[model samples]
Target chain A: MTPNILEVQNLHFHYPDGSKALQGINMLINENSKVALLGPNGAGKSTLFLHLNALLKPCAGKIRYKGADFEYHKAFLKSLKKRVGIVFQNPDHQIFSASVKQDISFGLFNLGYSATEAGARVEEVGEKLNICELFDKPTHFLSVGQKKMVALAGVVVMQPEILICDEPNAGLDPGNYKILMNSLDTLYREGCTVIISTHDVDFAYSWADTIFILDQGRILKQGTFDQVFKDRRILEQAKLKPPWVFETWEKMIDNGMVSNILPAPRSQEQLYNMMSDRRIMKRTTPKIIEYQNV
Target chain B: MSPNVIRIDHYAYMSPLRNVHPGEKIFFSLSTMLLVLAMDSILISGIVLGVMSLIIVWRAGVKCGYFLKLLAIPLGFLLLGCLAVLFSVSSEGADYDYFIKVGAVFIGVSVDSFWNAVQLFTRSLAAVVCLYMLILTTPINHIICILQRLGVPAIIINLMVLIYNNIFLFVRSADEIYIAQVSRYGYHGWVGQIRSLSLLCSNLLVKSLKASNDAFNGMISRGFDGELKFVDEVFETKAGNIAATVILNCLLITIYLSGRV
Candidate 1:
């Protein structure tokens, strides 16, 4: 079994105004996997993300990192923060430097890297994100999409073991969305644990190996995509629509157009491939025609 | 006005002399400003202004019109201030060489006061020009780097960095709120305009506070302690440029002393 990189046990939290943000939450995030937290607005996704990065302390729970109880000491937090970086939803919130190069290098410098080392890391991340040309540009002068890239590059430069993003695709154009997804994919491929919170069901369905459905500060369901997304009760309770691939696959199966026992398709391409098998279509069309005639 | 400031900052980043060592630029500007302030001669002030203007426009590659526009901003304020030095009013009309008498009052510009006003105007203009040359050619981050090297206290430098970065954030936030209000016809009439403007200001204040909290959390998640460390591009000091800066300062001082004597 893969070791859990992070675990949360009965986490409870409240805002300073006494509003409950998280209530009795328990979760386990495995190492080297793409995890997606899916929920509607005000469903405590962002709160959970903050807890994971140790920005917020749970009032009545414990967090464990690498199978050990997490420590909240300053020195321990510094080490933990170095290993887990977060890219905020709003670029303006995370980017505190007018210079793009300086912003991207901020995390590296905080990690005690020499100036030369930090500069080299900044260059490498800039090249990876294709933002090298924007290094000298003022952060305010950039378009929203460019600012998002810079913010992501700022966290990516740290080379954290776990990279968590809050609403990574929010406000991005389609082209930028694809670029961000591909960048995250590359990071996942390179063995980083990439986690994202999003309301985009299709993106989560297609990308995440594991999905956690959060609703009202509680985990409605948590499992592999096939397990969590297959539960219609949880989806209805969370006010989330099933991914189109799953809906289409279910309709085809109910109509005897495809075998009911086949594995669920997680993407449009996968669904198309399932439907395009000539032998299955040939076998199912006769049964469909007979049923229609009856 | 805010947009114009942003434009100036953009030009600073793109200035041809952006890669020059910031220490050299800071030294040149400060020395020239000191000479203009110390010399107490209109001719020296004029020379310093001319030299700084030439550097900003021709050497730094800032547009001449844009530089003139920037200079015009302070010129208005300086003129208003120089008025106090230029004219005096007195009840008795005997002490002034030049006076306009109205009943028992005299209001005129004396020769001594006239010379002082001229000196003040030129001095202030020269100082403004020197500062502009520095700002137009060097990015604020580079200036911060120079300050850090010059042994400025870390707390002050950190505050400067935060304020410099957040000024843009503040402007952008305020702009967003203004646009949102405008779209909703929040500024339809006098009353609505006041209401909308007030709302925008209050919203900006709240948003800025929230943004600061978020920014601090983000900084902490990246291992930030008390101090802020930023990377700056390496710039080699040029011997020729330094030499030219020294020669120009010496010449300005020489001209100022000669005029004084």
Candidate 2:
């Protein structure tokens, strides 16, 4: 098996207000994988994300990067943060500078890059994200979708190995949603490990290589998308319904419309293809003739 | 957005001179203001005000009506101040050229006091016009960049940046809460309005604190240390523009000095 890029072993965390945010969480995140964390509200997904980024140290247990135990010292943290970049849920919470160019250059500067190098990276990332036009605009006047794009650009400019986003699609309109999803897809294609915590089951089911069902500060189940979604108990415990595509496939199989057993389709296109294949088979099949009718 | 903030920001971002170097604008505004203050001549003050008003309306593309509206904001206070300087209350009217008798007292304006009041009003108005011209042409982001270039301490600069960005956030959150409350009939009456407003203020404060904590965590996750560093776009400084600014200020000063002589 390939070595895990990140490992969480028996991790636990508590808020300053004395609430347990994470409880004995364990997982191995493979490199270059698209991972989705799904849960109801207050399920500690955000808490775990913070721990992954080292913004919050686990009260117990440890986090491992590559094969080594992750250190929490100042020097190590600076390097760790460079490898693990997180975009917060609210753009208002993440964007600090009124100038878009300045905000995008923030992480590069913290990484000790010279101004010229930082400027080049900002331009590159801005073009990749299609936000080069906003470089000179004031962030305050941007719409919510634009601010969200700026916030994502701020972190993407850092070029982290692992990109964790907390609800990247929350509150986005359809057009902005497509833009964000496309951007994440581009990053994933570039061999970046992308982790997203979302409430949209359909999106996770279709997009993720791995799905983690989190409930009440514990990861209820973690496996390949099919393995986790096929388990009714885990879905119930996580307070989530099966993705619509999975549900429709299951119903078709039960009603004998599809006789051949197949794995659940990951997307609407895949499901359509499966159904079309059945229609094509029927069309090419030989038909019986009745001589008495002639 | 509040109408006032929207108006100012709209003009600042859309101004025809927005692409010009901020330093030149700042230099012209500040130097002209200093001349107005030092010379204290009505002629100099009037000329300064007229020039700034013309630039703001014509060159900056701001409407003349809007400029007059902004000017009216401080005119009320100036009039109050000028009235205080013009009117004197005394038991005897011997020292005054004109007086109004109340009962046993006299209140009136003298020629000298009237002249002083006029100069004070115009001077203050001229100073306000200078400041407005600067603000109306240059966005706050450019101003902050200029301040950073001038070596403002990191702590103050960071604070200013955060505050400026969060003002919109706070305003948005506050507006959302206010709308929710109004929908629930929280402001149907006088007492309800007071209660709802107070509740909105407290909720906004809590939200702002939460937002600040989130912002700090986000910063840390991006490798933020004690200092904040950002790249600023290099603005081209034209010698011709600089020379023009200098010549205009010199002309204003020459006019003032010639009048003095």
Candidate 3:
């Protein structure tokens, strides 16, 4: 496995009102891997993420980024935030500039880049996100999806090592969702570990290679979907419904309709294609080629 | 609520003069406004009004009717002020062009006050349209960019940017709440409308406070370390914008100088 880029070890946090937000949480985020953190509201997802950036100090345990414990000092935090960019769930909150171009350049300017450098970086990210045309537009004039793109571009311009998106696709329409997913895909291709916290099981199943189930201030499970979802009890405890693709994949394996040893399908189309394969390997990895039933 | 409050800002994004440097627009509008005040000539003021109205409608591409409606907003106040200037009291009834029959006083317009009121009215209208010409053509963020470059204090600039960034958001939320209230007949009667408006105002204040806190968190997430740093907007100020400011002001000044105020 690749080296862990971020690790939370028995991290605990509580609000000032004494409400426990995170309780003895442990998790590891490997480098350059797509991770989907699934959780219900008030599950400490936001609190845990805040700890990752040292915005909120963990009450008991420590968070390590690139093997170094996150320091609460100013200098360390500035650098940590520079590397771990967070795309906020609400674009209105994230975007403070009236102009899209200026908003995208905000992070770069904070990092003390020269105006020339910041402008170039902003343009580069805008082009990558296909928001070049929107650069000149006012922030308030943009549609919700377009505003989300601007917010994403603002963080992407920082060129962070890890991009933690809080519900990035929450309010995106179908077209916008595809565009946003494509942008995330491009960022992943460029070696940014893209992590998104989402409630959509099917979306997480299809997209994230690593899945984490977070519940009641603790991480219930963390692994690939195949490893985590194979145990029905854990998912039930987390109150998360299994991704339909995972259910179908399991049913196909149990009925001998597909190779039990084969990998799980990520999408409906992939599952359908698997069912049409002429060669089927049984549970014992039988090397045989025959026309399978349609 | 006038929907135009939000529309006016949004329309600036569609402005044809957007590429023209905001500083130049600021320079042109302010200098011309000052010139109108200094010259106090009806011809120059009239020309400024006509030219600005044309530029806003023709050049900036704001709808003519909408601009006219916006232009009408100040007219009522102008009329009241003009009325105050147009009439005066004299117990001696000295050359009254028109007079009210009051027992011990004559209140009426003299030829001088008439000319004064006309110029005052025309000057005020001209100045307003000039500002509109600036506001409608240049986005507020660009103007804030100019202010930042002009050595404005960072705190004030930050506040301006924040207000510019979120004013429309609050406007939209208020509008949505108003719509939802109207749907439920919460604004059916006059009393109901008053109650609904007050509730909306209180609710908006609370919602805005929450939104602001969240916005601060968002800012913190993006490496905002207390200082509101932003890349200043850079524009390749075309010779055309400079020429327009210099030439148009020169023309207005020439018209002022060549005539008696």
Candidate 4:
């Protein structure tokens, strides 16, 4: 649908010990959509990511990128990998270069860019990521936030159209997390498809254009935040709570403050404005209506 | 084991030696070791050792005792050198004119052999200390950078990099092992500790393998080709670094030549 950039058809994946990591599943990611893959621990969110870049082979399904089946072709898979860059959860595991500059240039070198082109790309991304100070510094010496930034810069320099990051904000400080989210916004604006697997519900609600709810190796629901998270039963089944803002909106709706919750406000400004509207007199009436049980 | 070892990685500690290229440091070490090995007499070695020690103090600002503790490692050589000179002296070649026995006791030994041993021991010790300062003060990355600039094969440089990385990884593994043992029963006793030790060893091996696999995955994901293309090339060498390195080399050469006697 909507010119899917990534199409997953009835995928199944299993570990060597016969543990299923991804049950029979199907999904499609529209071009330029910033999506979040949300799930609890052991929910196979990471396994789903590995399949995106062809890092983990599918057991019984096909992944097609740009309308080309990538199931059997090695060259296609390699090209797919180049197009879809995955920033791993562990920055330490991902960063193998001696210096920040080298780490960024690593992918470009692999992509067979000329020395001049790779160097230019490295400089550009290093500047964009605010890592100009770290270009010469050793990777090991960098702080966790700096390391993650360096790792992200490394992947970004390759100019991938699709970015799939697994738990990118797992150990981030608020400042670094905001910086990363801002960068993701920037990347989305640049027409890159951004996919983040996260447990940060607020981040997903605020940032993602589409959200995929994963549970027990399956994608149970996929839609805009309002569509996926509006169902409290589904939320409970997935073992996740809706974002605080979403919860507030639901409370306002049950109190007859509004006829319905405005489609999960994507920004604080939008939520603030919608709540403060005087035209909705019902919203102005404090404690006027009984709130509904979820 | 010392906090200083960790602190040594900080820039303030390394600032003095950062100016010298790793190749230059290696060269100085080689020359000093050669001079120590080639010397036949103790007097020349002692003077050479003294000169080297003075240069280390002047350049690196390191203390004599810190280095002496390190030199304590090769003290066996000092003992052996002294013993060899003492026992190998030809009876006919004895320089002492009077074999004086003070009341049926031969108490005094030849001064020549004793001085020779002292010279040999101190000179070799000094050389190692200078090299130690060179390594301890210069960052490993800079050293690798210098080596790359000096036209070393990319493969060799890469191997050195992997080895350096592995040492840190090994340290991390050791730390994890220690924590795991402490968490489970608090490292109680020696014999019972076998379980923890074995677990640590196995876990370390597994982690190393997993790390290598992850490294391979990262390399593949990032488009790592065979040759390591430098992201940031060494554009220029600092004048102060070059000047210091040249002066140190000159001083080392002078000490080495003086040690020939």
Candidate 4 lDDT over A64-138, as tens digits, reads 897888763545644765788878787765665456776677566555578899898889987787889998887
lDDT of each residue in A86-123, candidate 2, tens digit only: 88888766665557897677667556678899999999
**Count of backbone collisions within predicted model 4:** 2
C-alpha lDDT score of every prediction, in listed order: 0.82, 0.83, 0.81, 0.71
The TM-scores, one per candidate, come to 0.54, 0.53, 0.52, 0.53
Tell the DockQ for candidate 1.
0.01
lDDT (Cα, tens digit) per residue for candidate 3, span A242-279: 98988988887788767546788889998887777756
Clashing pairs in 4: A107-B222, A110-B223
Kindly list the interface RMSD, in angstroms, of each predicted candidate in the order they appear. Answer: 16.1, 16.9, 17.3, 16.6
Candidate 1 per-residue lDDT over residues A1-294, each given as its tens digit:
989998999999997436899999998889999999999899999888878777777889999989877786756766777778888787766665557886677556556678899999889998888999999898778988898999888888878889999999899999999999999999998999999999899999889989999999999998887788778998999999999888887888788786446788888888888778875543633334344553
User: Which residue pairs show backbone clashes in model 1?
Assistant: none
Of the candidates shown, which would achieve the greatest TM-score relative to the real structure? 1
Best to worst by lDDT, what's the order?
2, 1, 3, 4
Clashing pairs in 3: none
Q: Assess each model's interface with DockQ, reporting 2 decimals per model.
A: 0.01, 0.01, 0.01, 0.01
Clashes of 3: 0
Q: Report the C-alpha lDDT of model 4 over B1-261, residue by residue, as the tens digit.
A: 222333345532445766555656665656656655665545545655676666656666655666566566667776777667554323443454334445544433467656666666666665565566566557777677767777889999888877766666566656544532331222333543564465456556655655666676787789887655654434344566556646755665566567564
Q: Which window of 10 residues has the lowest lDDT sum in candidate 3 chain A?
A: A278-287
